[model samples]
Target: MKNPCIRVLATGGTIAGKAGSATRHDYRPGQIGIDDLLSEAESLGMAVTLSGVQIANIGSEDIGPAVWSPLHAATVAAVADPAVDGVIITHGTDTVEETALLLDLTLPTAKPVVMVGAMRPADAVGSDGLRNLANAVRVASDPGAAGRGVLVVMGDRVFAARDVRKVRTRGTDAFRGFPRESIGLVTPSALDWFGAPWRMGEAARFVWPDQWPEVPVLPIWAGIEPDYVTRLTGPDTRGVVVAGVGEGNMPEPVRQVLRELAVRGVAVVRASRIDEGLVDREPEDDANGFLAARALNPPKARILLQLMLASGVSVRAAMQAEFDRR
Candidate 1:
């Protein structure tokens, strides 16, 4: 039997970072290349043929539409290839979850799409990049990983993109699934899944946009000035996501500004500032013409709203429907 062919799509993150010294925490991310990283993985001697494809070499914080467009295109092409069995994206931990969500919403889920990253720089003491890379390859090559949407493998846990979040600033255990536990676990010898099989795919995907839309997340807080809300309205602002306090609530002043924006055809979504909870529609939300972001954090909500605006479909209805999903 042939070895499973996995394309290691590299979007540089800490996994590729190089520190001043093994003991030093300060380092520059994206300093190493995909070929170099793959060489480390190849040393493990897994039954897999790894092809390194360099997509971008930037810290995850710099990830935006410029990188997303090409990443999506390359991923789609790799997935469509007859010889490729699965794909792995090595990304930065800071914003890997957002990128994972974006790919999960746009790509076909028939094959495994795994996002892997390291909390520590590749050259640091106790560096975890190789372990994560090996684990990601294991998951990608696994037949069971198919149709489960994009998976983020870190700390030996496999998280579905929709629920994964970067919870800690530094550590081996930086990522977690919110409101839901990890769907599975991975080890050197075995893979185990705990949840019922659920899939996300092109059947429920948004059309990849030619132009990325401008959707900004505005944070709401105690004594938030009205200018903060009012300034968000402009010709280029296609949508606005408010990281509202507690169940997506804001002061009446902020609500009024949002209401006006909603009336002007800008998509307005209220997502929670809290980490792990649903933002359901309050009674006033309907009257104000606002959509609740449900379990989506502010950043993910912004991504979804941008897609909705870019497609120019039934924006209001689509936003509401997706937010309502379990």
Candidate 2:
């Protein structure tokens, strides 16, 4: 059988970072380029033809619509190419989940799209970038990986994009899949599957606007004020996601503000700030005109809301169905 061909899209992150000293704490992200990363991956002797494109050279924290627009277009185009069997994205771990979720929502291909990142700098002792990159290529080449939407490969664990989140700041085991175990695991010999495949709604191509709608995420904390909610009522503010306390609860004052925003046609979504759990609809939430985000974290919920609003879909019904999907 012919070896699968993979196109790697590299975005700057720790995997491409370079520290001045191996024992130093400070390092510069994106100092290394995609060509070098791929060259190292090739040394692993994986049975695949690897190619790379430099999408961006910055940490994930700097990732936004400017990067997302082109990245999405590039990914869609790459997967559509007959020569490319799968796509792999090298991203920074800081916000890798957000990027993965965005791609998962947008990409329509059955071919694999795997996102890989490293917690340590490329030049650091025991750096994991090469191994993670090799594992990502392996997963992408596997036929079983098709139809699984976007998968995040880190520390030998494969997580569905929708369920994966960065849990730690500095560790090889920085990502975790919530509400359940990882869908697959990467071994030295092959990728192993232990869970059923899952995917989001069919890809809906979106035209990149000059500016994406301004949707802000507000966290609920003790003594939180409703002043910020009022600011979100500005014309430029299209939507808001409340990272509320347990079970997606917000203060009464903030709830009132959200009700006001909803009355004015601004979409409001309720998501838990906690790592894992379901946000079911409650009477008060309904009365306040808030949509429950179900199992989605605040950041992911924000992305979904942005896409739904941008596509002219009914936010309430769409979000409810997304959460209720099997």
Candidate 3:
């Protein structure tokens, strides 16, 4: 491909952060603008033409429907444009997994959409943002990446949005794939293959809603009171995902509340607190009218459940089938 045109959608993160000094521990996120960030990435000279679009300049911790809705619209537009070959999203590492998974669930475009972020601020002495941004552009411009769904490029590894997670609180290689390895690897001059791309396309697509539904992730801890769970459910509560103990097991009292909620037409998904494992449905789960989260962690399950509820997909079996898609 000759000078593949890649559109960079910048949502402020550490990748755009500004600090007092190169080694300072404290810094302001999104202090740098998209033009400056993209200019730095372009300076790396990766042979790709770049265009910039600033979606938001706040940290990813504040990312919600407000940011996601517009970002989703911009991504859809970019993928549909004949002149645009691919898309790159510069997002905060803190919540990149959630955003990436949300985009993967909603978008069905054949063009590559790659998200990137950094562990250190853009102005830091050893910042990884520019390299990640450049690698994201490379992945987006690669024809082989077209049908890989949404991807997160970090630490020189390309992770499927569905499988990526932040494993460490701080570090350049904080992200990792759960229940699977990275789909591919990339450096400045080379790309290596691994697992096959796992893009579901229309089969897993969820229409971006005008307003996202209310779905909260509640963690089940020892001695947790039932009122805590009750407080989270109300007139507007569409669904809940409990990050239960091993195999998604919770104390009897909490389980009872969830069962009642499930019977009352509120969707309940039992996701595990364990870092990486399956929460397969069991006979007891069927008897309690609960759905298992399978391989989805609590946060990812929350996003998926939110999309399902917003799309008017409340049937228990249907929702369970969505979880079983892996």
Cα lDDT tens digits for candidate 1, 1-326: 99999999999989999997999968999999988998899989899999989999989999988999899999998999999999999999999999999998888887899999999998888999999888999999997898888999999999998899988998899888977869999975578988655773445378899887778889987899878876766798888999988988889988898899889888889989888868878788778989999888999888888877877754566679987773
- Candidate 2, 1-326: lDDT as tens digits: 89999999999999999997887778889998989988888888888999999999999999988898889889989988999999999999999999998888778847899999998898888888888888899899987887778889999999988889988888799889876568998954688998655543345344444556789998889998899777645788888888999999988888888899888888888999998857888987667778888888999988888877877766576667775551
Error of 2 at 66 (Å): 1.0
281-306, model 3: which lDDT tens digit per residue?
99998888888999989999999998
Candidate 2: list runs displaced more than 4 Å. Answer: 199-211
Clash number for model 1?
0
Q: Assess every candidate by TM-score.
A: 0.97, 0.95, 0.97
TM-score of 3: 0.97
Off by over 4 Å in 3: 198-204
TM-score of 1: 0.97
Q: Find the 10 residues in a row with the least total lDDT in model 3.
A: 195-204
Worst 10 residues of 1 by lDDT: 195-204
How much is 33 displaced in model 1, in angstroms? 0.7
